[model samples]
Target: MNRPRLAVGATLACAGLLAVGCSSPSQQAAPAEQAATVNVALSDAGCSPTPATVPSGPVTFAVTNSGSAAVTEAELQAAGKILGEKENITQGLNGTFALRLEPGTYSVYCPGGQKDTWTFTVTGTGPAAPTAAPDTNVADATTKYHDYVVSEVNLLQPATKTFTDAVRAGDMAKAEAAFGAAREHYESIEPVAESFGDLDPDIDARADDVDDPAKWTGFHRIEKALWQDRSLAGMAPIADKLDADIATLKANVATATYQPAQLANGASDLLTEVSTSKVTGEEDRYSHTDLWDFAANIAGARTAFELLMPALQAKDADLAQQTEARFVDVTQQLARFKQGDGYVDYSTVGDADRRTLANSVNALAEPLSQVAGKVV
Candidate 1:
């Protein structure tokens, strides 16, 4: 039920929109470009407003879930990565996210429809060269965020090894114990993982995400064998691949570029990640260690928000204060579920508690959503 549903290798030319074309994002729209708005309707059948052509430059996709239980998200993809997207749009919700797109073709993915994908060609030349350089603070935010991602990767690479080594050694208790320890690092920097083409899925994709079950690999795959199957015999290959993939992510993240606004949007994405799947306890169905991921996702968003604080505060102090307050609200609420250094099993969370957690996420998401616009 939960996976990186947006990670079908579906991408965004400019995504992470909640403005209701229900887009999701790995990055934000270009700052100087004037945004062109487009509305796409999502239904059980498919995306309704499939535009054949869109003019070049920035676009805001307002994706509305016109009544689709299964179809809850949408994405815009280009060049093998998601630029932006808005996801978890259930039956009636609508939201927007923006992107600065260069001329070319982009894919619109509304997973769960009969015909789940659409293509739109971006016409005309792209944005004119910027007259001024970006704000210095914004530039610093990007650089710092990049470094944060690298540091998280440094932690993840070794932690994954500890987990994988336990898996291969047939030590079920050790493997299970190391699972949540390793995943929190990846969870904290998921948007960085998503920015790479198939890296996110290769490392984190669940069984539901793949067309063929045999193809499923990565953390969850090993997780299922450890918790559900109660064996480690076949996991050596999966463990090796998982470690190799994290190594690849560690290598790629050092060179990746970022926009300051993406930090805000990435925070939004992290919050959305919590609200969408993790909140439902579907993220770690087998292990029941979802709260670990829940914490990590929020922590990642919090990191981005902190990194963007300088720029965000410079632009809108009131918004910054409100955003910070909301972060506290959510953090306090989340702390209720914590036990020791980790959180309680997701299975123990009652419906009322889940609602409280989801509510906190929504409260923070509202303000976090606005951060990019003001700061960028």
Candidate 2:
């Protein structure tokens, strides 16, 4: 029987998101006193009121769960801007979209292609803020990094499939060969494992050998299992369990329970890392680990912005205010990464190849945090 490789990257993306997304702002109103409220529903049918609009500057969205099945999450968008989204919708029968928004065009969207179809607008003198420029250089580098990681992650999928096919076909040797191919991919990325540490600790935590390898224990163990020369003695039973677990995980991926508020409450690990990524002096060169943290923080801030857009549109002062405050907090946390000297060295430093890890860390976090705080 073939042993399955783990979809560790999926968890990596999620783990990073959870680390950062769990820190949404406390409930607060927008600066404008009377924020409007819009109540909506999500279902296999569609979002009602094909086209919708609301006055801007602090709006509140009260979403009611009238559908037969439960709605796990909600989002608001307009002009490529994510206005608001709530992942904490456990009210089996009753739920509310409590959020604040700013003046702008908006739409209430849902995950898994459950778009609201209707378009909405929030009109008013919204909060004044400056524009944010995507750090193209940083983005390009990060994109390359993400692609490399994704490729390695994707490579395991085929190997896993091969293992499954072999097991189902009763071909242990073929399963072992597929496992070998997968292991090659893992070895290719081992030198850079430190870079993936924050994004994928599960795979990183595994031992370096085949026999006595950690069994397919979710992301890390399964991933490590894929790379080993199939321990036929050990791999057979593990393959049986993996085949079952994959089905369960895929089934739950879509309608899975999401707790944004709960997630928001547990962001200290990533947030603390963001806050502490400060640069110290001329030694400002950064490692892949710093960049990984940088990407996670940026993604988190972006998620928060999208989560709050709807509330801003509804003129939900408290919701908008709270989101803004969270943004502020996240940004402030990021700011600690910036240098007190107002300059960054994108290149390496010193004849001895010493790096000013502190300063570069601060530099990466500061601008991103500023962008997150200001990008409405």
Candidate that would win on lDDT: 1
What lDDT tens digits, residue by residue, belong to model 1 across residues 27-90?
Answer: 3333455666778888888775546577765566788986789888777765556666777788
Give residue 323's lDDT in candidate 2 (0 to 100).
Answer: 48
Best-performing candidate as measured by TM-score: 1
Clash count, one per candidate: 32, 52
CA lDDT of every candidate: 0.77, 0.37
Q: How close is every model to the real structure, measured as TM-score?
A: 0.85, 0.30
Compared to the true structure, candidate 1 yields what TM-score? Answer: 0.85
